[model samples]
Target: MSRIEKFCAAFPDGDAERIEEMLHGYLWDSISVRDTAVRKNMKEKFYHGMVLGLLQSRSDWLVRSNAETGEGYSDILVYMPDKTGIVIELKYADDGNLQ
Candidate 1:
């Protein structure tokens, strides 16, 4: 079976399309982080994109961000239907060529 099929089996009545839309929008918005904060912002945004992508593609998942931390999270958190949560963390590096 396809991955979506497996995912959907866990969430019979959820809208997969809406999940895709949210993931697309979240990823598209993340592209704006180019060189400004370079190291920090890109990693955080990429991690966030991954979390959002999962939330969007999988019906049995609900995602949330902690506004209190204000971008200091290890990664975005995704709560899955299996009653488990995932924290996605991203790390990036500069080769000393773009100082």
Candidate 2:
């Protein structure tokens, strides 16, 4: 089986919460060297694109970037194979303020 097939087989329900947990853990462990801050020059769009690619690669799911919603535009929208959708909003904080 392929990587996507394996992931789908492992998570048949396309559990957004579980995927979120894993993704969060991945970002937490993969990055962050100074308490809660990351290296300089890495902006919001960079992380946003990275996450978009990661999600697509991991699950091969249909993901839309900067999707329009009733309220406003969202940073990311993911369509799961189980006929569910996940919306994500992204934010950025420069070196000056992240509070």
User: What TM-scores do the predictions have?
Assistant: 0.41, 0.53
- Residue ranges of candidate 2 with Cα displaced over 4 Å: 1-42, 58-60, 95-99
Residue 97, candidate 2: C-alpha displacement in angstroms: 8.2
Q: Candidate 2 on 1-99: residue-level lDDT in tens?
A: 754344333444657566556656666766665434545545677678866776677445788899889978999998877787777776665654647
Tell me how far the alpha carbon of residue 89 in candidate 2 is from the true structure, in angstroms, after superposition: 1.2
**Whole-model lDDT per candidate:** 0.53, 0.66
Error of 1 at 85 (Å): 1.4
Residue range 10-76, candidate 1, lDDT tens digits: 3333555654455457557665655234555466466555655654666556765652345575445
Instruction: Count the clashes in each prediction.
Output: 0, 0
Supply candidate 2's per-residue lDDT for 41: 46
